[model samples]
Target chain A: MKFDDLKKLHQKKYRQQFGHFLVEGEHLVLELQRALTRGTLASGSVTLYVSERYANFASPFEKVLLNDRQMSQLSDTKSPQGIVALVPLPEAPTTIQPAGKAIYLWQVQDPGNLGTILRTLAWFGGFRCLLSPGSVDPYNPKVVRASMGAIFHVPLELDVPLAALPDRFARIGCLDLHGESVVADNFVAQDCFVFGNEAQGVPREALSAMGASAFTIAGQGAIESLNLASAVNICAYEIQRAQG
Target chain B: MKFDDLKKLHQKKYRQQFGHFLVEGEHLVLELQRALTRGTLASGSVTLYVSERYANFASPFEKVLLNDRQMSQLSDTKSPQGIVALVPLPEAPTTIQPAGKAIYLWQVQDPGNLGTILRTLAWFGGFRCLLSPGSVDPYNPKVVRASMGAIFHVPLELDVPLAALPDRFARIGCLDLHGESVVADNFVAQDCFVFGNEAQGVPREALSAMGASAFTIAGQGAIESLNLASAVNICAYEIQRAQG
Candidate 1:
């Protein structure tokens, strides 16, 4: 891809149009290669771009050599890591399988929060991320970068409507101030944990539609709420703990 | 304060020199006021600055109205929240009492990570945060902002060397890959949970000095590690869970 076209991958529109997204830094490129080796990703779906300094780095996919200026132009970060990969965007599944773990987000606006949530989900494994319409693009460079390469490992369904969650999962859980304690032995098995926007929490109507049960990570301090990602992390960990 | 001087609060040097820091946004300002009302914060230690738009907002501290431009100048965020507070930095205590919850961060470089950890610590309550010498400044504007006013709620001790931890806490727990599972029944009560830098784990010597016991949050997936803040959150939650 031309540097101009590669740079366009930084934006959501270009990523959607080209059906590809950029992954930078050596760590992520290594992760992409690992996914390919594991047959989790298609072999020819990645195109690696590297500066001359890193041109000799062993990569399984087709490689493009670029100068520092071209590499910098293609990078989303201020200090370019000299390696970028254009990976085909995996098709979002229209229907999700029931019975496994899943996380549903409604209009989560922060890329960092989305990324960290994905990382947590990937760490636990067996969890799919369902993003409601109007959520930040999962393929946004910031999200991809912050995900620490979990973007490749975790399955993501984009533009999922909150109203449709009931059809997809058996139990839907959400965090709320007046919810059941997540640590309670009576906390039901939830296939989907729905998180809301950072500012405005899960809408009441949608919660009722999904028959969502509220769960709270009870704490002693004066904080009004935990950061969205932290809440998800604690919830995911609790699920793992319960299963173990 | 002059605009130039107000702008200087963004830097750690200036904050240290002036013995004060800035808090922005309506939520944090309200939190500051709440802290004052609850007697958690000293009166007359906060100087609120507001744009004409928010001039009528009730605050316990003295308020200075500023123009939009001046408000923007005083704010650290790209979009000024039109409210700012100059808050005096609490004096770091020379010694910490043993037998309560505490978190120790060593060389944690990310301001956001430090901030989120503080927020988590505050939410758990009865927890003090101890920063080893090389960690990011808890008072950095980004840290303070990301803290969501937890900066005011959580007690912090800066520039604490790791070697001094044993003198303060009897049991120091550190997360590790090969350690005892954090969810295990044998997980002991620890006065301090030592978290390491984002990239580097805790220094070997320091961990040894603290007699830090290792604990792992077991996961099935191939993720190399969890985000530092997420790890800390999980640890804090586990501590709360064990106690409850």
Candidate 2:
């Protein structure tokens, strides 16, 4: 791809037009290399771009040497880290199975929130992330940076509608104010744990459908809600504890 | 204070000089009102600023009417929310008496991370937050905005030195990779839970001093580490669960 085309990867339209996304910084580039070594990512799928300063950094993949100006143009952050990688967007599975633990986000609009949730999910492993329509683009530059390389590790499915969830997952769980306590011994493993938007929460119809499965994290304080990522992290931890 | 002086509240130096901070958006202003009602915050301390459109919104405290341009000048966000509050900075206690649950952050540089941690601490309630020297200013505009009003609810102590901690608390807990699992039945309450920087874990000297008290959150994946705020949230939740 030309440098002009590479710059287009910063926008979702261009990323979609050419099934590729940009991963910036040394840490993420190293993670991408590790992913390739682990076979989670295909070999020769990453094209690395480095400035003169990082030209000597060892890599088995194709390397494109770029001047300082080119490196700055390709970076999404101020003070470019002098290195970036163009990797093919991971393809989503056509069918999501209902067997293992998974997270489904519905209309979550914040890129940082989605990125943090992905990081948490990646840390816990064994979970896939499904995004309902209207959620932020997981491939957005801010999301990828905030994810701290988790984007390359976690399996993701995008643009999955809420109506399609019931057909794929036998058990669906969500958080609600008056729901059962998450710490209760009765807390069971659901095939999918659903979270809603930052302000709106899970849709009313979806909550009603999942009625008894809604759970709350009991607390002694007056805080109205937890940050979306924090809620997901706590829940994911609890699920892992239950399995143990 | 003049509008020019109010604009200065966006910076930590100005906030300290004037002993005030800015809270943006309607949700946070409403929370401030609630805090006044609950006696958690002083009743007359908040000065609300709203554009002509939000002039009709009810507020218990002093309200200043500003035009669109003035509102934009006072806001930190790209799109102004039109409503803001100049709140007196909460005074920190000179001496921290660590009698119950508390969180201590050391050299945490991100305002968003600090704010999210404050939100989690407030949700659990009955906990105090102590910032070791070099941590992000808790009163920064970005921290206040990301905190989602928890800034008004949680008690905070700033510029505390690590050396002072041992004199105040008998037990201190921290997260470590090789420490005991947090889910272990032997997990006990510590007067303070200490978290370090985003990229760097707790300082080696501090960890060595509190060696036996360190704990780890067991996970199934290959993630190197959890986000600092997420780690704090999980630990706080586990502490609350243990107490119950």
Candidate 3:
């Protein structure tokens, strides 16, 4: 790939056109290498870019050297970490549903929230993140950065439709006010969990149509809502605890 | 107060010197009004600033109209909400710990993380936020905005010391990798919970000296750590669930 293309990877449409995304910083690059070694990512699908400071970082992947100025240009953060990886987007396994409970996010907008939620899901394990059609792109640089490298570990399915969830998961659940307590026994039994936008929660008509069960995280009604990431974090933790 | 003084409230030193903080946006201004009416905030300690659009907004507090440029000048967000409130900082009670379990944050720095954590604390209610000396100022503009008005609902004690924790709470708890599970019954009976910084967790020396009980949120350990706000959120939910 041309050096010009690496800069373009910072933008979403260009990333889509090239079918690769930029993973900057030593932490994410290390994770990319580890994932490739673990066979989670294909061996030859990554190209590592490094400044002279990181040129000697040992790895099996092909290396491209960028002068400090070039590295800074390709980096998104104010303080460039001197290393970046261009890795192929993971292909969805269309023939199979992933072997875990599904977490469906309906049009979550905040990049930090999406990234943090992905980290939470990966930490708890046994879960695949399914993003609704209007959701923020998982490969967007901010999401990738905020995931703190969990973007590589957690399985993600893009453009997953909220309307299609009913046909897919027999038992879908969401958090709401007048719902079963998350501590309740059956709250742990859902095959999939759905969360809504930060401002607009899963709507009433959609909830009724999907026949989705509702669950509650008990709180003192002082504040109207929890941060979207916090809500998902609590749900993911609750699911993990109930199962364990 | 002068317009110059109000603009300076964006900085921590100015906020402290003037003994007031900026709460921007319509949601926060309404929350300030609600809080004042509920007598949670003392009467006569607030001044509302609004653009022409919000000049007619209902409020018991004193209101000042600023031209759009002035409103924009006082606003921190890219898109100003045309309403701002100058609220007196909530004074901490010297004689007693507030009536709730304390959530002691040790040097948390991120404005968004602190705000989101405050929302979590408020949503769970029955919890007081204790910020260690070096933590981000709760009154920072970004914290105020990100909190979505929960900053008004959550009781906060600032500049609380880590070393003073033992003298304050009888049984302090913190999350650690090798510890009793958060689902354990004993985790429910804590007087306070201590969470550490984003990068550096509660130091071993401090944890040992405080004799803080350790609790774990079970995870598959694919990621090294959960986001600090997410960790606190999960803990708060677990505590609420166990108690309820």
Which one is best on TM-score?
3
Q: Write model 1 residue lDDT over A93-119, tens digit each, in one string.
A: 545483458888889999998888888
Candidate 2: C-alpha lDDT = 0.84
lDDT of 3 by residue, B85-143 (tens): 88888777665766878889999999999999989988898877899999999888889
Considering only the true interface residues, what is the Cα RMSD of candidate 2 after superposition? 1.4
The residue pairs that clash in candidate 3, if any, are none
Give the candidates in order of TM-score, highest first: 3, 1, 2
Query: What lDDT does candidate 1 reach at residue A129?
Result: 84
TM-score for each prediction?
0.95, 0.95, 0.97
How much is B85 displaced in model 2, in angstroms?
1.7
- Which consecutive 10 residues in model 1 chain B have the weakest lDDT in total? B91-100
Docking class of 2: medium
Q: Which residue pairs come into collision in candidate 1?
A: none
Give the candidates in order of DockQ, highest first.
3, 2, 1
Best of the two (2, 3) by TM-score: 3
Residues A148-220, model 3: lDDT tens digits: 9888888888998888898888899987766888888898899999888898888879888889999887787
